[model samples]
Target: MAIYRKLEKEDKEKLVGIFQQPSAMYDYREFDEDALIADENCNCIVIENDGEIAGFASFITYRVPTKGLVGRIEDVIVDEKYRGQGLGRGVMEKIIEIAKEKKVSLIDLTSNPKRAAARKLYESLGFEIHDTGVFRLKIK
Candidate 1:
């Protein structure tokens, strides 16, 4: 059986290994050791399958000033070999529990349009597709 737990300070090397992929869901190029180990607002959870890190989810909680308190799912990644399993759902469910504890009124995330399965997972978990436009400027 797999175990879902919070990232520990000792898990840095393993976590970095998971984040090092070029096509990772989150940009961890500047992933800092201190933040991963001590940041109160950062919650990084990992799933261990037979003592190996198989997947991870990072969440951030913050109040958008006038907009109110909200939680944002920074990233969710499951190993390619574990894709068909319900690890992603487990990650989200755990995050939802944390969000509720933090009194977050809303939780949001942005997913690639090409990730159809991921979209379905989010939608089934009660996340709605809002009719809003998002613009980004990439730096080279």
Candidate 2:
């Protein structure tokens, strides 16, 4: 079984182990736990199985003039070895809890269309695909 907890800076080693391609998981060589904790509106949590990181998810809540408070779930992942065990659900549930606690009016996320399983999970959580355009310039 996987146990869920808030992420900490010290969990870097265990977290890195969960990603097959570390580059895809994170852009930096080191996990910046300090930055995450210091951020006022972001919450991150991790799932541990037998003292190892099984999965993780993060969300950021922001206030917009027109939309009120909103949250976006990001970096959701479960180790390939731990996928079938409902670890992803555990992580997402935690994110939803945080969103509710923060009084966020809406929460959203984006997943690759190829990730059918991911889309299903989000749907099960009551997320609907908003027919909106998502554009990025990719400045980097």
Candidate 3:
């Protein structure tokens, strides 16, 4: 059985293992379990298969002057071994549910063009791409 639920402290080791998978697009950042759990604005969902972590997704809600409350989904992934089993969809659906519960006015996420499958999933979940440029400044 697969269980989808909020991330718990005990899941850190397994979650870190998932993040260690190589991704040309994303670099692994230090996992701040305490910060994630302490911050009310951050919502993280984890999928557990049998006794191991199988997938994870998260979103952060913030107040925007023009849009009211909005969310940005981030770090969605399923274990490589668990791919093609609908775990990604299940985790994403759980994130959407959290967004609805928080009354978020809008939810946004960015996916690399190379991630065709991920982009397709987002589109199927009603996320439409807006014609806008994304700029980032690496401060670190």
Candidate 4:
């Protein structure tokens, strides 16, 4: 059985493991314990199975310029061994609840076009692809 819950400090290593997976696009290569602890708007949730971390989701709520308030799903991933077990959905549901509680007016996320299953899951969760383009350039 899997359980979705708030990430505790002791669980930092486990949370990092999810981000460290080769397939994970979370960009946690620079993630540190202080980052999670110091950001009040950041919420890290994890899905654990029988004491092992299997999936994770990270969310951030903030007011964007011209966008009042919003909750952004920074990342979501379920370990390959646990993908079909509803763990992804479960973690997303938990994150949604957290967003609601935080009173975010909107929730946003971007997924790779190749991740059809993930896109479907986001759609089922009421997320839609906005008609806006997302771009990025690494400063380093």
Best candidate, lDDT: 3
Clashing pairs for model 3 are: none
lDDT of 1 by residue, 1-140 (tens): 67889887677677766666655645666867667758889898888887888888887878888656778887688776677788889898888888888887778888888777878888888787776622111111
User: Which portions of model 2 show Cα errors greater than 4 Å?
Assistant: 22-31, 133-140
Candidate 1: which stretches are off by over 4 Å?
20-26, 133-140
Q: What tens-digit string does per-residue lDDT give for candidate 4 at 63-94?
A: 87876677778678888778788899899888
Q: What is the TM-score of each candidate against the true structure?
A: 0.83, 0.84, 0.88, 0.83
Q: Candidate 3: where is the Cα deviation over 4 Å?
A: 23-26, 133-140
Query: How well is each residue in 99-140 modelled by candidate 3, as lDDT tens digits?
Result: 888888878788788878888888777777877622111111
Best by TM-score: 3
Model 2 weakest lDDT span, ten residues long:
131-140
Cα lDDT for residue 78, candidate 2: 85
lDDT of 4: 0.75
- Model 2, 13-118: lDDT tens digits are 7777665454235443645889887887878788898888787788887887977788888778888877778888888887777777887777867777877787
What are the root-mean-square deviations of the candidates from the true structure over C-alphas?
5.9, 5.7, 5.6, 5.8
Q: Where is model 4 more than 4 Å wrong at Cα?
A: 133-140
The number of clashing residue pairs in each candidate reads: 0, 0, 0, 0
